[model samples]
Target: MGANDLAKGPQMRTVIFDLDGTLADTSGDLIAAANACFRGLGLGDLLDARHDAGTALRGGRAMLTLGFSRVDGVDPGEVDRQYPVLLDAYARDINSHTFLYPGTMDAVTRLKSAGYAVGIATNKPEGLAETLMQSLGVRGEFASLIGADTLPVRKPDPEHHFEAVRRAGGDPRKSLLVGDTATDRDTSRNAGVPSVLVTFGPGPHDVRALSPEATIDHFDELDAVVAQLIG
Candidate 1:
């Protein structure tokens, strides 16, 4: 059956997470990699984590863009040539300061222990996401991982979340999409699954306006939220 048909069936047994701000605090590595790229090109450091994060591409390309934009001596076209350099640097330093947000691992562990399948759905590239998950020591924990390139389209399309459900071998009617942005909320809505929006990340637009199924301030509240949902 098509992905759209899943949500209408039985309830989901999986919980899919959006990486980066949701599952891991990857800003440090992302920012450091960008700065390193800048220094490598002799442009010096220019972007700050809080502000530059919004400008970075959806994933690795964002880091590449941050670095390329800071290099004063390189031609804009030449930036493409330097992308490989930035990507290599990023992959090498993927988890330098990356860590799970407070209570994230515990929450995931708790969920799995309670028999809920856990997975990841992120805009980050597959390779980078895999590397980060490995570095964080949680690679084997996830039942499925859907990165940006996993499908022809990404978040805000609903397909990605459905694909995540498919990979987890579960139904979406019982699943919840947990993330930190409006695109994620949109994805859940389109997929006809409930979505939980985390407030501790980069949301280029107004999250409240996006109107997720629910909003959370910290990981500590997630368990209670889920309980509320399943009840």
Candidate 2:
């Protein structure tokens, strides 16, 4: 459908988002860092490893663990050692290949201007989430952000979502979680909020199997999804 078709929809109240593949496409830089870690240890680099990283593109740390796990008998310390290299590489090139998904920034800007509370809730670690948002010039863009380490538990546990809702100053009934992973789906369900799943990321299983409230392949479809949730 055309943009005009979507514009006829009613506005939404509050929308929470996932980072990584859902908002920013960090796979290219993350793949570079993961491979840098592998090459630092004198292992043969596989393009498939990078592609594998695309599926679980939560953050640098998760990518590191996923990439390094391919090497059998590798010590956790070795993985730990590689993390600094990844972090250092990413610190310089975080936005090099990472960008907001199409129409994402526009949607976010419109929502904020419409008086809707906006927040970010992702499985990425709390510290890096804040740092990346600021570094990429979208930090203050979110009224609230909840990362994996933000609380004693993470996604798949509803407390994190509850905390994000509290921070965004919205009731769960008026909020929508937009993400691309089963973990995100579970978080929404457990929090008693609606979720919209995007079909554009690496997830271990089919997103539809998780039973999100809605599913779409583009950010352009988000307005209707959000309208249904927050109406």
Clashes of 1: 5
What lDDT would each prediction earn against the true structure?
Answer: 0.77, 0.76
> Model 1 over residues 54-137: C-alpha lDDT tens digits?
554255456666566554555666557666766788898887777788888888888887777788999887788898898888
After superposing all C-alphas onto the true structure, candidate 1 shows an RMSD in angstroms of 3.5
Tens-digit lDDT string for candidate 2 (1-231): 788965653333668898987888767777776776678778756335345745438656676676667768778777567777877776666666676777887888877776788898888777777878887788887889998888889887887876777688766567878888877888888888899988876555568888999998887787767777677
Winning candidate number (TM-score): 1
How does candidate 2 fare on TM-score?
Answer: 0.82
TM-score for each predicted model, relative to the true structure: 0.83, 0.82
Name model 1 segments beyond 4 Å from true. Answer: 1-12, 54-58, 63-75, 202-206
